[model samples]
Target: MPKTQPTIRDVAAAAGVAVSTVSKYINGTQRFSGSVEAKLKAAIDALGYRSNPLARSMITGKTRTIGLAILDIRNPHFTNIVKGANRVALQHDYTLLLVDTEESQERERPLIEALAQRVDGMIISSRMPDDAVQWLLELSKPVVLFGRSQQFPIASVGTDGHLAASMLARHLLNLGHRRIAYLGFAKSRWNDERRRGIADCLQKAGLQLDVHDAEAPSAIAGERACSAILLGSSQPDAVICYNDLIALGFMKEARELGFRLPQDLSVVGFDNVSYAEYASPALTTVDLQSEKMGELAMTKLIAALNGSHDDEYAMLEPRLVVRESTMRRPDTSQPAGVTEMTPKTAGGRRRTGGQGA
Candidate 1:
């Protein structure tokens, strides 16, 4: 009822070559004359022959697979990173094995350990503590850190969150926002970096930030934090969110509460995700070059697998993108003490004549 699968011996016989020659060709251990190559190809095609990857790996001592562990697969920022890493892996004729830790520290070690058994090396974007990550280095596999940098003797690639947040803070400060609030994520690995950047910038102007933390990084968490931020004793002129999803949620809830965007309050977010520009009034955010970080991390890991002993660290610069979500605050000394909301036409374009900062 079933036919036997062709083996290397069958291929060699069909091509009229030695079994060793067929092995060399399949393993890419040596080159052959064009005639021999063509004959081998024809034989393999006719027999529908396929080499066993396990057997080949046994002989070569390389699985030719790289494992990538991400904290959360739902985030578009991490998705872009995967795209960049997969691209480089394919170019090098290697397979990429992906695992999502679901932002859980408990899942990271077990997932990484299981992946390590099958792959040649790993690229980890983890939420685990630093000591826990340092423990992983003892696995004896080439490991690259993604999305964060450290003084550890491992290669790492990440975006400068502090610098990016500082830029956003400065942008809002220049807009005359005196009472600024920062909405942060409790589980974020770089939350302190972003918060510190915003705080440091505001301190220069003799102002302090009103800090609030969301239980999670999702839009739901952001939407839930809206009441505390907007209904508090001291209302801020502007709010800076941890990421675009949170910012979008905050804006939606703020509007539902009858506050006009940038008229009653201003909002800014980080990680200029794809939909950030397509939001109702668009979103002002930071570009962290997520894809580039992925590419660099994969490249560095592959380099280590090739016996290159150098440790490299790459920190990408962030760019600020301004959109309609933020605007200059009304001058407090004005006779009216507040600026009137500008009317928008039916097509949703604001009629001209608003004052600029």
Candidate 2:
């Protein structure tokens, strides 16, 4: 009572050709004369024969699929990365299998292990420790790391977080923000690098950062951090968030708590996510070139799969984009009991009261 699907054999029989000829035509392994090509096409159309990808993969040992594992899909920064990787995958006729690790370290290894079995290669944006990543190399499948670089032999693509954060810290310092705070993501290596950059720059100017950690790199976590940052014993003149989502959350909570943007407080973030430019007053942030990172990672993975081992690590430079959310520190008095710091030059010399251009 059921109709059976046609196979390559059916097309070969209908075209009066050998089964190998049909296979070659279907796989594009050989080009035939125009008349032979026409005949095969006509026979394929008549029989409604479709090649089975699973069967072909069993024979060729290549699934023609790429696995992309990201930390959290809800973040626009990761979403843009996916777009760039998917574009390259499409161009190469490879299917992209996406998986979200949901920021779970425990899930990364098992998820990647399972995914690696069915894909030709993988691109991973993981929070796993470097030692844990070493195990992935044993799988024999090409893997390209996204967003973080390591000393391991695996290919990687990432932006320079330290440089990016250093630039942002210098910007805030130039704006006369002596009391600066950093809203960081907990347990993140990238966050550590950024904090170090900010701290290094501040230390050079004879100032230090007021550090706070968010449970996660999300708007809600950022909002929750407001209590510690704004209502703490000392209030900072400016806050640099780990990413745009956190910055946006902090801004929202700050406004609800009677603080005005760049007036009562100045705020900046990293990642330059789509929401950054569309926030109430727009946000000043660093551009990590997330999309380009994705493209490069995918490209590198593909190259590795093809036996090319050069360019194992690609690091993109970050750019700082200034917008409406940050401004020169207003000449206002500090909160009661909080010390006011005179703006200092990089060499530790105090400067007269004037904002940086």
Q: Top model by lDDT, which number? A: 2
Error of 1 at 88 (Å): 1.6
RMSD of each: 5.7, 6.9
Stretches off by above 4 angstroms in model 1 are 1-3, 30-39, 149-151, 332-357
lDDT of each: 0.83, 0.84
TM-score of each: 0.87, 0.86
* TM-score (C-alpha, index-matched) for candidate 2: 0.86
User: Please, what are the lDDT tens digits per residue for candidate 2 over residues 240-286?
Assistant: 99999999999999999999898878899998898788898789888
Residue range with the least summed lDDT across 10 consecutive positions in model 1: 348-357
User: What is the alpha-carbon lDDT for the whole of candidate 1?
Assistant: 0.83
Candidate 2 Cα errors over 4 Å, as ranges: 1-4, 14-16, 28-48, 331-357
Q: Model 2's lDDT to the true fold?
A: 0.84
